[model samples]
Structures are given as C-alpha cells and as structure tokens.
Target: MIHEDSPHRSATPGWLAVRLPVHALWLSLAVLAWFAIAAFAPRFGLLDWRAGLGFMVMTAGPLLLGLAVLVAALALALSLRSRPRGPWWKAALALAIPVIIGASLLQLRATAARVPPIHDVATDVVDPPQFSASTMALRDAAGANPLSPYNVPLGQLPAWQGRVEGAQAIQTHADLIGQHYGRLQPIPTGGRDPAQVYDAIVAAMADIGLRDIRRDPDAGIVEGVARTLAFGFRDDVVVRVRDGRIDLRSASRVGVSDLGYNAARLERLSRAIERRLATP
Candidate 1:
C-alpha cells in the first residue's frame, strides 16, 4: 500500500546509503591506506616490491576509482531525493582521497610517458667512465647482471626493463641511451684544481646518500652507487675530473627506463655541487 506522503518511497539504496557518512568515511580511509601500502610497504620490507607495485596499479587503483564514482553518485542521488541530508561532508572527504591519489598517479604516468625508455646517461659515449672494483663486487653479491648498456642475453641486465620484455628489445634499448643522451656535456669545474674538485664530487655524492663510494684521486675518477628509497634499486655513478671539465655517468642497475630519474638526479647533484662551492 502506497501512502500519499510516503517518506520510505525514496530511491536511495539501503546498501549504498549507510550510516551518515560512515560509508564514505570507510572507503576514503581504505583508499588512503592502500596508497600507503603501495608506496611504503616495499621500502619497509612489509610487502614484496614487485607485488606491491602490481597490486597498486592493477587492483587498488581501479578499485578506488570505481568505488569512488559509485559512492559519489549514490550520495548525490540520496541528497537529491528530497529527504534529510545525512552527513554529506563525509562522502565528499571520502571521495577526495581516491581522487587525489588517482590524480597524482596520472601525473606520474604523464611524466613517465614524456621520457624515453633509456636508463643510462653520460657526458661522453666514446668511453663512458668505468665503475670500480668495489661496485663490481657488490653487484656480484647482489646477483646484478652485466651492468653495461650492451646486447647481452636475457636475465643479464635485470636493472633494465627490457630484459623482461624480451631478448630483441635489448639492443634496441641500448641504442636509445646512446642516441638520446650522447653528447650530454660534463660539468665544468670552473678551472678549479682536480684534487679540490674530487673532494667536491665526494661531498655531493655524500649529500645524495650514495653507497660504495670508490675514489681514485690519481686517476681523477670517482665512482659510487645511488639507490631509490622505495625499492633500493641501484644506479651506478661515475665522475671524472678533467683539466677543466668534470664528466659524469649515471646508469640504472635495472629497468629500461629509469622514469627520468637519472637525469633529474644529475641535475640535483649539479645544484648540490654549486651550493657546496658557493659556501664560504
């Protein structure tokens, strides 16, 4: 029997319409927690790095998006039903979480798309600076495959993304770094002495929390490895102090594209060096 003034005749789904704002509240918190797991679990050893990334991209991302839309639509519908507005602000806050996370991820992807899938960058191509014995030993212990951008068999260059992509993509990726970043100029030492410049390079590397620093003062070559905080992924680094120029090379220990991290790292190091020298 339908009443003329039926308050119960509203279209809000009981399942969708939960305790004023609690549904949105829980959903937002869940989305935020999922984001945290995706970001920090790999770093803290709480989750497998590969699995964490996969879950974030494949599962959590889509789930947040779909759930956010569903809840937002339901909330809007309920509010428009001429019934009392239950804590709508909670729904807004809940929706904001997934929206924020999704927007950030999209920006990251857009930046990545603009970058080439090359992991190595150097001042010169003819003879890129070589790493020291310490780095080689560490890589060996870590089971890091051949560390050069050359045509090696699959599983050899684990740091590169193409290794997983297939064997044929190996040389194709190697050619990318050489073709793109070749002729990338070395930083000039402002005519400073090589000894002084080497110290500065060491200081700069230290500022960036580099590992396994190897110094060859006589040869004017300094080598070290940088690691990403989240996954401890390694990037080999070498600095050469010439008469008036300082050459630099940075190559990811794995992955075909470093997401433009290597180039950005070099810029940060360059700025750090300038700051160090600027200090009286």
Candidate 2:
C-alpha cells in the first residue's frame, strides 16, 4: 500500500539537493587525470590505448556515473522515510557516492588521456590531367605504338614506378624521372607537354583493357586499373620515353597472403605486353 505521495515525501532533502559543484569537481579531476597520464608514460599508459580507453571515456564513463548518481538519489529517498530518526541511509549514501564517483572519474580520465586528435588536409586542387595538351599527344602516340614506352622522357616517371630487381637503382631512376619530367621541371626547359604524355599513357592503358583511366596532363600523371588473370587491380604506371631510352614503371598493391597471386598476375601481364609489342 505504498502511496505515490509517500514515496515523494520520503525523498531526503540533502539527497534531492545534490551539490552540482561536486559533480563538476569529479569531471575536472577526471580531465586532469587523463592529461597527466598523456604527459607521462604516454606510450604504455591507457592514454595510448586506442579502442578501449576511447570508447569508455567518450561513451561509457558518463553513463555509468549517471547511474551511480541515480542510485545515490534513491538511497537518499529511502533515508527520508525514517525522518527525525537520523536516517543511516544518508551516511551510507554519502560514503558510497564519493567512492563510486571517484572510481568513475578515474576511469574517464584514463580514457581521455588515451584519446588522440585527428588531422585532415583541405585544398582546392582540381582533378588530374589539370592540363590536356600533353595527354592528347600521348593518346595519339600510344594509338600508333602502345608498347613503345618511347613517347616521353624516362626521367619523368611516376613515384610508384619501380623495377623488380629488388635493387636501389629503381628508386634512384624514379627520382630522376620526377626531376626531369615533372610539371615543375619539364624536359628541354619548358618544352615538356603534360597533356601529350597523359594522352599517350591513357591510350596505352586502353590498349591493355585498363579501366577508370584518369590523366593529369597539367601534372604529367596518369592512374588506372589493369585486369590480369581473373581479377582487376589498380595500377600506378608512369611512362617517360626520352633520350632514345624508354622507362616504364608498373606498380600494384601486394599483401603478404597474396604474394603468389600477385607474382602470377604480374607474369601474365608481362607476357601480354610482350605479345602486344611483337604483333607490330
């Protein structure tokens, strides 16, 4: 026969009037603890923990603290039922409240300490082939000799381009290509046409059934997908054919588990290129 009025009247005054400043204190302490951990032992501490600490601090900490506060309020209400008797519930609640709040605050602080900030870049650069004249010429030349690799300068190859010798020469040549063929330093001192190079690469890729071909003639770069065996993968092939020498670089993503697959695919692609070139 508990009456609603009785329940409302039973709520203790001190319990009903929780000091908001106390909660603020807990929050402040939690924030400080997090920062302290981040400043010291940052690597091994919870502050460095990505998933667990972040989730608890960002979502679980507040929820658990709120629940503990509700429980304290309930205890206070029960204590008021024995008014004038000096409710023991009030003492019990007071003791439990601080302990629960402190624990939650500590955990939240640790989580906050571990959480890291994220950064992103913002720019307004237009899409690839920003210039098209070089690309057009590349496409035209590629139509005549798709496998020549002689249409552009060898020093202007893509960064991802490399030879499979597992040697350092590949990287050295790649840098040279960038310096000589990049839009920043066109061959023959301003004579390098990005649009022509882009067009040539696009035409070559098309000849090999590559899709999603994109060219940045302004930057003298091209990227696309090439199909090999039964699967399709992205390719970052840079071409520069200058000084009577042709430099071609083809790169595809590889994973530890797919080493065999990648090797086989590359072999097949090489054979296809050889056959295409021999045809003419």
Candidate 3:
C-alpha cells in the first residue's frame, strides 16, 4: 500500500514573521534620517549650497536603494513559495532590509530634533527715545560746568545696588526723551539706551568717514572709529557738576571702563548741547 506524505509548511521563523508587517519602521527611519540631516547639516557645513545638495543625494540614494533591496527580497521570498525547499535565511535577510532602513531613518530624525534655532535682534530697526536739541544742549552745558545742576558726585550717591533704577535721573532723562521724542523708554540705570546713542554716534562717526564703531549699551560703553581713536566705556565719564567741581556718582551699574567711553561721548554730546544752548 502507498502512503501519502503531508503538505510542507512554510519554514519562515516566528521573529521574522512578526516583524514582516512592520513597514512603519522603514518609514519612521526615513523621517528620522531627514530630521538628522536638517539638525546637524548646518554645523557640519553640509547645509552649504553645494554640500547640502550632495548630502541630500547621498542620504536619499542609500534609503531608496535599501527600499529597493527590501522589495526585491520580499518578492523573491514570495516567489520561492512554489519551491517550498528554498533556504530559510533568504527570507529573514529579505525582511531585515526594511527594518534596517527604518532604524537608520529614525536615527537621522533623532539627530535633527536635537538642534536649536538662532535668534538675533541687533540689526532690526528699533525706534529709540529722542532728545530735543535744546534740552540736550542745556543738559550738556549744565553737565560741563562741573558745578552745574546735572552734575552729581558718585560719593554722595548710594552704593551700587545691582538693580536697574527705574526712577533715577538717568532714567528720568530717558523718560523725558520718550515723552518728548516718542521713542520707547529704556531702563534708566543700566546701559539700556546704548542703541539709541549708537545710532547718533554712528551718524556722527560717519560724517567723518569713520565706520568701525562698536557700542555696548548694556555696559554703557561705546568705542571704535570716530574723529579720533576714541574708546570709552560707562562709569568713567558721568559727573554731576556742582559747586564749581565735578561730582562722580555711583548711580547705576556703570563700570570704570564704561565711564571712560561715556566721558568721551558726553564731550561730543556736550559740544552739540553748547551749540544749541548758545542759541537765543
């Protein structure tokens, strides 16, 4: 009597069988790779026109190739169904292609997600508090006398308290400019209004064909090219003129270097003030 043998079952492994339907892995990986490129490309110079284009090609090419290989492997596995005796490793290898691709893509995306964006407001057009030619002239002339109304000695003022005074004389001056000139009020005590002063200084410096002026308003210091090789910081120049003498005050967070720059700028500002003060 002839015996009939049982039909052969497909010998694919359980792990591969479970992983076969995970097409999302490849897609995820691809997304990750794109993000990685985006995040780090700038730092590595890969985002440069020529380099970025090349990087894009390289990244996409390998992913597409892997996908193609995956598709081919899957197709081959399916085609081998008829033979039933084909190698088991072939099926596992075919499935792994897409999984590897997905993992790579995910890695790239993770890298991209780690980068932070850059922010800059320096060159933006900011409306600064304005000062009237007459008022500024008066203040400058008063500041010049060393015994005038605006001059105050640092010794008589309170010690540096580190907080920006909102109602100090310097702040009051800034407030006056805003009220009279329609510009935003800057912090009075700190070097809050350096940008405003910067514009004026730049224009003044430009008149003499000097271009490399640097101003640090936070420190109340302004330096670089002007009529002369001028360098001044805050804290060195602000003097309250009183009783025919110069009174230096530690009203704000102005430092010694800052004062030096302020002194220089104040001298120029004083000249402008004098011109206006002499008028009528």
- The sequence of per-residue lDDT tens digits that candidate 2 reaches over residues 181-237 is 232221221233444444444565666666767755444345454433312223334
Top TM-score prediction, candidate number: 1
Those runs of model 3 whose alpha carbons end farther than 4 Å from true positions after fitting are 1-59, 62-66, 69-73, 79-83, 117-280
CA-only RMSD, every prediction: 4.3, 19.9, 21.1
- Quantify all predictions' global Cα lDDT against the true fold: 0.69, 0.38, 0.35
lDDT of model 3 at position 103: 70
RMSD of 2: 19.9
When sorted by lDDT, best at the front, the candidate numbers are 1, 2, 3
Model 3 agreement with the true structure over 1-280: per-residue lDDT tens digits: 4333334355454344444434424544554465456445644554642343245534564566466466546644543553333443444455555556557756755643331110000110132122233424543553421211222322233332232333432432223222332321121222323344445444443443433444444433333322222111111122222222211111111121122222334445434423433333
Q: Judge candidate 3 at residue 4 and give its lDDT.
A: 39
| Residue 215 in model 2: lDDT | 55
- For model 3, give the 10-residue run with minimal summed lDDT: 116-125
TM-score of each: 0.77, 0.24, 0.23
